[model samples]
Target: MKKIERGMAFASRHVDIFKCPVCGEGFEEVMNGSFSCSKGHQFDFSKKGTLYFLRHGVKSDYDDIKMWEARRFVLKAGLFQPIIDEILSLIPEKNYLRIVDVGCGEGSTLKYVEEQRTNREDAYVGFDISKKAINLATRDEGSAFFCIADLAQLPFASKSFDVILDMFSPSAYGEFDRILKSKGLLFKVIPNANYLIELRHMLYEENDPQYSYSNDKVLTLFKRHYPHAKIKKITYEFPLSKTFFESLVYMTPLHWGAAAEKIDAALAKGLNKITIDVLLLIVENN
Candidate 1:
């Protein structure tokens, strides 16, 4: 089947989860190139099979195709399989539960979980602000719904999702609370100070290894929003693939503003393996 055909088929399957971004009405159906509401608010799906939910032009560094491609490649190596396992473990054993992934760049993390799970009754939706990311996400996988939408203003209905996955992505707790059902689970993963420490060490000054980090304030904010939040610190080391070494460098924002000379210098050192230390927060909407 064609990519757009697959996309429309997926849209047809989960048309209920979408809310018109402009009129705030439930989508009635998917027409030729767009999803429309009864009130006539329409959002067009791209030829690549993804919908754009942004109301305005908002450019970010995450839109780079090279970055997302690199991310797709590295993540396929299962470097963060532990986190995926934890996410799957938190999911209730049922069908037709709505799951949304906020800031789902390239869609690899959620795709991996969906592929691993046996249940096919659950509806999976992924949202990212980058159209590039969403395009890549929906390129081949038509099973899950993909939208280029903002975190602050989700195009999904209130009390819609059963589980929200915020993996290394920015969070809008207020928006999350508004969209999730009561007692809905939110699984968030934030990088620890030691996450990609070796890469940081290589890209920056030798005197300032600066590998350790604190999420105290982040946790405090989560607790303020969701009183029943639980935290887990996961730390581990994984060997780097010889082939994906360059991809690892490009896949992250860690080296974003670093001087090219410095980046080149870091690459010369030849990083072998890196640390994967992150804090996973499982909070409930009340």
Candidate 2:
């Protein structure tokens, strides 16, 4: 994947002595301030505050500005604001909290959380593998420092954070374990099977909807990784406007394969409102 922007250099930690978040191993090198494991795994260092350690490159489908803009519009419409508030309500109010947001596209979720948090301590880090997403996130959400890095191989040492937020983003259980402090909490927001049925129904054409997802699966994944972790799920629906319809399409990977002609047709239909089903899970970062 290509790196798209030049970010302002921010102070960063030198990843020296630590084990690989994914595989239990020790670091052997610290080149360019990045910690390298002896197994030949290398994670990128951020001049702006963290590391990109996800093994998978950015998804080719989600590497555009159009999708981000659409998401921005939909979120700005307050469709997901209540969801953010709900997550905040569960987090304990504290002064010196270190929070990390993974796959933070265009930084809307981080921005909203930042606004809602009663008092913040230390740092707010938002990282993603997509430079496009990180750049946009940094530009719009100045309060949270942005980094273009993989989540599976985070740069920080183990037990470094208080809270980790993963909203509609991919997960790296081991990496999260390494960075989260014992007793740290993680809030993950995923979609139910019928997340955006309207778009999926129209896009799928004739096939039965293929939106296969299960909160139980997420709970199981979390349990497998952190047996001591506690899980709580929150589900809600919000109305989306015509503008939201456009943003929702772009912001998500649900309709990436639709032909341009078909997409144009869908756009012509122009929805007055759509429904959103958001699932949020909070877990103890054992």
Candidate 3:
């Protein structure tokens, strides 16, 4: 039997529940039932019993190794320490034995937390679509599974994970919902509107078409799959340097711009500092 099929069969035994906020529709249990919309929008289940209803299929090859290395440096510099602290604080006391990091890039966050956490042993799986990312994560023997897979097609059983980490990555809500158990928690770390204000100021046309408003956008998207969603926002200032400037230049989404020439000119002024406001959402499976 295929791995996914086995998971679905097991999940069906538990009798799962689903709801779509966009349509105000609910299904008591879809353990063995088909998933569909009245407007003919239907999503089929994988062998693992998770449904994928991704309307858009956009995946791209990330930047080169130099870019990845820069991101690794910034994260390791502890500039985003506030994010780490908030995540540790919100973690509920539970006997959660399985955890997964969706779109886990290079596994730095998971590696750090695993060292402090004795709550669960070898329960961490850092999954990403990029084999380069997965290879980097697998080097950490502390982590359990490192796989190159799509979020919309998670290779796990329904209600299998105790916690799902969606940190600064594309979210697959249906897959997240399918993989989490009733008591499971999803820790989503989204960028607040002012996340990288200095970069925005430098890149955008007078701070218009900003990336600052992603918090509400993300919440709105996820509220479609789960109820009782709430956000916890944290703002912090990071001391910067020449290396920090390089890291920010390439690692951020702000790097893409039609006004690249202007942005480069602004950055040359040797302005060596910035702040980040992040939203750490702790949404429970309600």
Candidate 4:
């Protein structure tokens, strides 16, 4: 069988999670490699085996091939292992579960977390806005299903997931809540002001006011959506070896907006290590 066909076959197992983004009708996964809505909206599975649900053309900065490539390399180095360990610790010890990762860049984090799971009944699926990222993610075909999708208008049915992961990704809380089961958990990981403190300092001047951010508004919004949410502030410094430095800077969008010369200058200075400061919010879909 062809690669795309096999991919579609694997994706067929969890067809119930999806609905027509255009008409809101449930999809029928045709074994021939397409998902069709009752209203005749048909979506094809790419040859790489990824399903695309993004109706609009790719517009995100993450759509670049280099970004995904860099992410793939850096993540493979286990730089995010500490964060992955915490994520694993929070997962409910269940025999069966559905875990959906939103904006799962190249599926690194999802794949890593899924690897630590001994439960064979767990179903892991990830979707992102970038086709490049989805392509990269599908390399681990049977491990998890990867698709190109919109975060705001998720193509899944209401209450389709047991756990929704929003790590460093944009959130559509209403949409997220709608698709998450009543008993579902949303594990959202947002960067703190100190996240990549060294990188930010390098990107801007020491006294540069824009070098920092305020997650106060973000916290307020999150609390408004999930009143009983439990927040864990995870802060630590991870050593960065010279081997991973290039991928580290390239993988992150933290310094992408800076001038090339400035970035080069920062690289010239060399980085021994950096901080991984983030807020992990565990909230119920209730």
Model 1 agreement with the true structure over 1-286: per-residue lDDT tens digits: 7777767777888777778888888988888788888799888877777788889998798889999999899888988898889878888777778889899999998788688765667778898998888888876553777888978788888898999999988899888888889878899998887888888877777564343456678878877886778888888887876567788889999779667997887776666788899999998777
Query: What are the per-residue Cα lDDT tens digits for candidate 4 across 147-221?
Result: 888888999999889999888888999899899998788999888899888888888775766578778888889
Global lDDT of each candidate: 0.82, 0.67, 0.64, 0.83
Error of 3 at 271 (Å): 3.8
What is residue 22's positional error in candidate 2, in angstroms? 14
RMSD of 1: 1.9
**Candidate 2 weakest ten by summed lDDT:** 1-10
**lDDT string, candidate 2, 1-286, tens digits:** 1121122123223233245655756667656655578786765556443455555656766678888778777786787777787878878777767777887888888887777764564467777777777766755634566666656567556787788989888899877777788888888887776677677766656553444545677767766776665444444566656666777777778667766876777777866655567667677754
Error of 1 at 224 (Å): 1.7
Model 4: per-residue Cα lDDT at residue 272: 90
Ranking by lDDT: 4, 1, 2, 3
Better by TM-score, candidate 4 or 1:
4
By TM-score: ranked, best first: 4, 1, 2, 3
Please tell me which model should have the higher TM-score, number 1 or number 3: 1
- Tell me the number of clashing residue pairs for each predicted model: 1, 6, 4, 0
Q: Model 1, residue 208: displacement in angstroms? A: 6.8
Q: For model 3, give the 10-residue run with minimal summed lDDT.
A: 13-22
Error of 1 at 38 (Å): 2.6
